[model samples]
Target: MAAEKKTAIPKDIVALSFEQALAELEAIVARLEGGQVDLEESIGIYERGALLKAHCEAKLQAAQTKVDRIVVGADGGLKTESAEIG
Candidate 1:
């Protein structure tokens, strides 16, 4: 049988939400671990997974930057402080 051509991942990878990207990455890992794909296909999926992982991380970092913690001032006033994300 002839080898099948590997298809590219769908468009707008960076546009995917953090959850979406993470889910896709998880699926890629499962597929890779399953060991059913040919080497070339595996390479393609691995590349896609890398992109997804990076996108997810960026989304998370952006979200972290927006997160804030409420603090009480000495005078009992409320203040918003950026939360540190590790």
Candidate 2:
């Protein structure tokens, strides 16, 4: 069998909650914008920032999918039915 491919993302990054990831991403953006980091460090931070952004987006999508389902009534009024979470 082919060797399993390891993920590029660090475990720490993967473990971070959505809020934490977003905060880190914002800090990375600030550092990049400040123009103080050297080229190599900047590149590394940029990569991490990209990963953080992806993590945040994924968290948002998951939350959206988990939100309560809305239904339309026969009388044209809106109703919300409890969404079944799997």
Candidate 3:
């Protein structure tokens, strides 16, 4: 028999790109809210959802430190600086 793929833990999910993590989180939420999963499955889904949420939050927190820079005045050049977007 083929081995079943294991779902990632929350920490592993945090390593994924924002888009990838968000997509997985959305899917988990849909499954939980769909009302079709059994109690056991629902519990598992809820766990996964929590992990995804944590991963997404960590990702956002890490991204908050990024910054961008711009230069102006006579030369009208560009500069590098910390980005200030959340």
Q: Which candidate is the best by TM-score?
A: 2
TM value for model 3: 0.59
Preferred candidate (lDDT higher): 2 or 3: 2
lDDT minimum window of 10 residues, candidate 1? 1-10
- Any runs in candidate 3 off by more than 4 Å, and if so which? 1-11, 64-86
Q: TM-score, each model?
A: 0.60, 0.64, 0.59
- Give model 1 RMSD, 1 decimal: 9.0
Give the per-residue lDDT of model 1 (tens digit) for 1-86. 01121333356885787888899899999999999999999998988887787667667766533779999999999999989878
lDDT of 2 by residue, 1-86 (tens): 01112235578988999899999999999999999999999998988887787777777877544458889889999988888777
- lDDT: which candidate is best? 2
Residues 15-67, candidate 3, lDDT per residue (tens digit)? Answer: 78878988988998888889899999898877777777666766787753445
On TM-score, the stronger of 1 and 2 is 2
Please tell me which model should have the higher TM-score, number 1 or number 3.
1
